[model samples]
Target: MIYINFNGSLHFKTDAIFTSQNRFAFGDGFIESFRVFNDKITFETLHENRIKASCEVLFLELEKFNLEEEVSKVLIANKLKNARVRIHFFRVGNGRYLPETNQCNFLVEAEDDNVQAFHLHTIETISLSKQYFKASHSLGNIKSSSALLFVLAAKEANKNTWNDAILLNENKAICEATSSNVFIRKSDGLLLTPPLNSGCVAGVMRQKVLQLLQQNSYQIYEQNFTVSELENAAEIFLTNATKGIQSVVKFNNKKLENNIAIELVSLLNKEIGL
Candidate 1:
């Protein structure tokens, strides 16, 4: 498949410019991955809104980026009827580690789909007390450019031969996965998820699961709970835009039965009309 990069009205073959040195630099706008199914993006509208809000929070002009159309064009040009797309937004500058707020660069990557089952490991993450006033926000909730923290953690898990890593907030509570939301089911049949303020991403599937739970009258609660609670949970599953919902069969030697997870999976697949 062919790939294209958008810089003003200029377009380039992705390899002509997408060198390691270029992508590794700091403050190159933001990058997000999307899965395309049957030629349509998964949660297309929400993904669009998310990038737009994130760009705004980053203080970059949306029109200047012209992201949605450019990425769409790349998809069409590549004839990617179904694939994975990585859209990156950047505010370029002259040789500074810190990028300028202006001179944005938008990149579109259409790659083959890679869907696989995932296993999770509970990992520790130090959550710095975020203060928004005198400092610029990095669009944590909105999803933004800074991903080294998650990237490093995921790599750690992989080095240990695990599929993915689960991160905990400073409070020692379950936060989220390196790229998804965490779900826990207690012995009493309570479907528990950490609150958004508990340092977890409000993932698209997470939201959809909550709504499906409510519609189906599942006992879903949003509150802060400890890692110990997860240890005792009857079933554990992770959700995201890509992997969808994956059952955590084990976490740090804690073995779990996938029965309840199977039931929920069946229900979710039907409820979401997947």
Candidate 2:
């Protein structure tokens, strides 16, 4: 059974539902996705705060609805102990080029994702021939409804039988993966990820991992590095709220080590009390 909360109303998966064009496909909005583990929602408040911040950045006025409450209700109604949930928030009112009203609309969807343990899933990635998303774009950092660059990257990855694609910013600096933040463990034992200014989404798990590593006295830095630097990286890992940390075993044809990634995954699972 599947359940969706569309515009403050709940509907079963089989129910016929319709959303207006302005709110469905063409609108100013963003999405926040996280996992519910052991019947507890991970980083729930963090995701909510990010959502609110994104709305402010977009100048969107949201309609009446309690986001956390709605999410909880959906989980309870479906008896979901472990699930991956996505909340879509978009503008509701009219206009062709510009929306007459900026009131926001929300839709929530969840699927059972009973991941009881954290394991290192090594991924094979390929670097794109050209930069797709301009990290310097106005809405680049925000996970907006307009995700053409991400779509293109995914299509390219599928064509090449790759697990993910590496995206670069305007300056040809490493940015992030399509849906996950990229991290490179250096040969000298330092971890580096692109700074937020480099156009990477401020992911919930990324922040958590940063804090966890710092607490453990690990040397981690957020700075831009070139593709040449990546070629020499000792290890490459991806982080997201759902999968936690995934080690990139190979970037194109270069093999990467998983020693640090495995340790970090253990530390992270312990930090999250999973």
Candidate 3:
């Protein structure tokens, strides 16, 4: 096999890395991620909507940004079909943390893939401040650049032999993982997860599962639960756009009962016609 690298920019295509000069970039943009499977995209609208909302939440005032169209164009330019995709919008820093009013950039990357599962580890973490209980707070529940805090926690999970970390709120209630929403199966048939009021990212998959639970009249709870509840949970599972639904085999050095998780997977699979 052979590969070649070239300088200078061209039009938007697989061969073109940028649309303008090196110092050229816009001041405001949004990013999105999607999973392509069997030549189809699941929950495509959800991913697009999240990108739009993320930009709006970050207060990035831009004249126009089209994420879905850009993604489609990039896929075609690269002669690609299905995989995981990420799109990030960039703008010039306003000489500070904020962005300037003019110029912007769009960054997109995708790859065909295959994945089995993710490993999870228990980690130490500090919850958010009481003032951040509301989503209207600057970084609360926005799914933005605030992942640094989660990164620190994920280090603890890795140090202690885990893939990621779970964070709690100021009240010591189980919130969510570093990059995903969490669920715990109870003795009852209800599926349990933290509510948006708990200061966690409102994940799209989480939304889908919740909708399924509600539609079938399955007992479900969206209230605060403690770490102890997580440990003693009859079943523990995790979900994200990338990972889908994963059963937690072990947590805090204890093995979880994956029976409920397996059943829930079957239930969800049946519901989604997967």
Top candidate when judged by lDDT against the true structure: 2
| Cα-based lDDT at residue 188, candidate 3 | 65
What residue pairs clash in candidate 2, if any at all? none
Ranked candidates, highest lDDT first = 2, 1, 3
Return the TM-score for candidate 1, rounded to 2 decimals: 0.77
What are the lDDT scores of the predictions, listed in order? 0.64, 0.81, 0.60
| Model 3 agreement with the true structure over 7-92: per-residue lDDT tens digits | 21114434545455332233234445556654455677777677667667665544455555555655555556656776555554
Give candidate 1 regions above 4 Å deviation: 5-14, 18-24, 64-68, 95-99, 114-138, 159-161, 259-274
Worst 10 residues of 2 by lDDT: 129-138
| lDDT at position 136, candidate 2 | 57
Q: Give candidate 2's whole-model lDDT.
A: 0.81
Ranking by TM-score: 2, 1, 3
Over 55-102, each residue of candidate 2 has an lDDT whose tens digit, in order, gives: 888888775667678887788878888888888888776566677777
> What is the per-residue lDDT of model 1 for residues 1-274, given as tens digits with 9 covering 90 to 100?
3657566333546356554456336655676666676566666676777777666766666565544566667767777666777777776544566554454567677776544222233332212112111111234464456776677877777666666776777666677767778888898888899888776765766877787778878889988787678878887777776666677767666676566456655665564345
Q: How accurate is candidate 3 locally (lDDT)?
A: 0.60
